[model samples]
Target chain A: MSTEIATGRDIALIDLLDRLLHGGVVLAGDITLAVADIDLVYVGLRALISSVATAEENGVPLP
Target chain B: MPEADDARLARLKALLAASAAEDAAALLAEARDAAREEARSILQDVWREALLEAAAAAVEPRPPPERRRVRQEEGTAVVEPQPPEPRSVPQEGTAAVGPRPTEPRSVPQEGTAWWAYCVVPAAEADRVPPNLDSVDPSGPVEIVTCGELAAVVSRVPLSEYGDERLREHLEDLAWVERVARAHEEVLEAAMSATTIVPLRLCTIYLSRDRVEALLEDQAPGLAAALAELRGRTEWGVKVFAPAAAVAASASTEVAGGSAYIERKRSERAAREEAHQRTNECAQDVHARLEREAVAACVNPPQRREAHGRDAQMLLNGSYLFDDERRSVLESIVEALAGEYEPLGFSIELTGPWPPYNFVLPSASALS
Candidate 1:
């Protein structure tokens, strides 16, 4: 367990974009939405598994 | 036989508990009833506030000519053209985009309406016609706009899984997929124009008025937000390292050896040391790359069982950059490839996606 603060600037723009694009205040509106019959969890899991599998199959080396 | 019977009983008990606990039908019924009551309460609380805020807020009177739009070109649907007037500053940016040319109206939902939304600027409000792209686009896209805020409402309800009867028969994986797709559609539509504020899954608004009021309440903040987000786009970059290759590199980097046993042990230690160093290198690469980009976010890297591949995912990163700098960013990534080639790691960048993670509540709404 190393307690350290790395002090070197000059970070990449992509990294900044990642935070600016994906990180923020999520406003969950007070509205109930009807969604399709399929499940979101399964979709995510399946996508994850298949993408990994595809990577392996395509020789991309799954991590 | 007795042990097996006990296990079966335990399974049954678990099933019974789930039925009582998370039954979708009961939850939906409860939520449905609650939404109705909550809707009324929200209306009551905000109705007065809405009127007061709209009056106090800077409600620019319509500049008549800016309201008329050039019709969509033949066969090519286009988002709103650049605001007819040019303004360099923030306050002026508000005037540049202007207000919704027409008042928003509600279309009735036949059965249950599930709210699906991807946030777009109020300027692109007209592009999302009501009931436009519902699973069956047979109807108009149920669009409701307020100032610079727009939500493409869908009447399709997500299937309830909490009901014991249906839960037993339901394919949960299938249900989530359908909902995600609905989310995707709205998000895709939003991405086509400006950075969209993606609403969470299964959010439903009972009436169009609430959305209008919401827009009214959040307008000033949303307007400023639109100005901030107008020109930028998002991209993703993930860095992965092959575990086997890392291990191999480690073994090959062994230092001096004396006795056979000591030498063999030293080789193993050397491999572990090299592996740790490689992991560190991978992290540095991602962190440095992110720091160099315009804006970047590093999400928790997901770990899974090694899939007989030589790689370990060291970083999963998303980036937001302006279009002009897309190539500049890509070049930086290419440069990283050259630098980290010796470490047996690779950086994969994918995107130009909607700013799904960057949606913020209008700041004025907070004040």
Candidate 2:
């Protein structure tokens, strides 16, 4: 808790993305979401997750 | 946030004024706007028609007049001493939804789609804090009720949120960051006052009708899930340590060939034991914390690119605890962290999140 490892600031962007993309109430079927339309988006986010990791490491500021 | 929101709020007010004027003229225009775009236009027409039918079979039939009064309390129309509706305790082991309704219609306007954020029980619907901003710039957050449940949704323009366009945007990290933050912002605000079952990112529909239909079809699961979720909070903890810390200690004294060979063998054995111990440490921490949680899980370690840390992640755990139990969970995490810190491990706690990991009973259980 004391070595600056416990962040008091907001959680990292990657952490939020991890939960938002990977977690939450997902139902099956096309009833509410055309579950197919977003499959590629999920895949796309997987790639972004890695890119975000790189950007943060390089100290890249998001526009 | 406030300065910008002032202007946005003004614009939102004007937009509502214009829509209110239009509502006097046409209300049945946007049927079905579901994934297939079945977003029907709303309220008295759809709410009464769908709610009464669905309520009859689902939980309890809420009187239409009472529900309408609840809607008024949502805005500046009129505030009055409200009657607490009978608490609708769900009946377990029953298919509590109404008859199969007509196929949801796909009638989204050329430019906009309904983006639903989360579900709250109908009883708590009126208490949703107001003036919340949505993912859509001009779209103000609002609740659309069906039967025993209601969805917190807003209109997102299709130009930006359309399936093809949304997929394109997901590749842009900045765009994802902006939307992801905003999406969480809305849910976070709403969840503060009430229990909410959050939908994943990008849950768009054609109309509130389709949103209602989702409420109808999923009522049983929704009620059951809400029952389990009420008064509970989700928490996450991650542990990281340098890879070298998990490696055997090295010395510079051995120089002979046979001595070097013996050193290598012993070092390999020590390294194997260290790795094993490190894993046990992670498991032991999660296990101890889980004891204080209503639900708990260990997710895959995040990649270096994901966390940007020099230390390799050993644990990424999420736990759901009853509100009263959160302090007990924290004490457990504190005790574990203090015990593990001297071993070169650092534990980070993150949450009060919207039960993201605990949302699906079946999903979390299987994992």
Supply DockQ values for each candidate.
0.11, 0.16
Q: Give me the candidate number with maximum lDDT.
A: 2
DockQ value for model 2: 0.16
Candidate with top DockQ is 2
TM-scores, all candidates, are: 0.53, 0.65
Please state every model's RMSD to the true fold in angstroms.
Answer: 23.2, 29.1
CA shift of B286, model 2, Å:
1.3
Candidate 1 residues B1-367, lDDT tens each? 6999999999999999999777877989878865664464356335433432222221122223212111112321112212122312222322211111123322232434435465567677666533335532333456677766776665543233112212222234444444445445555555554555555444444446756665565555445555555665656666665454334322332333235336545544654555565556556665666565555544544343322234655566555566667667788888888877656666776655555444432211222
Give stretches of model 2 more than 4 Å off: A1-9, A28-63, B1-109, B246-256, B361-367
Can you write out model 2's per-residue Cα lDDT over B48-113, one digit (the tens) per residue? 334322322222123432111111111111112111222122223321211112343333325767
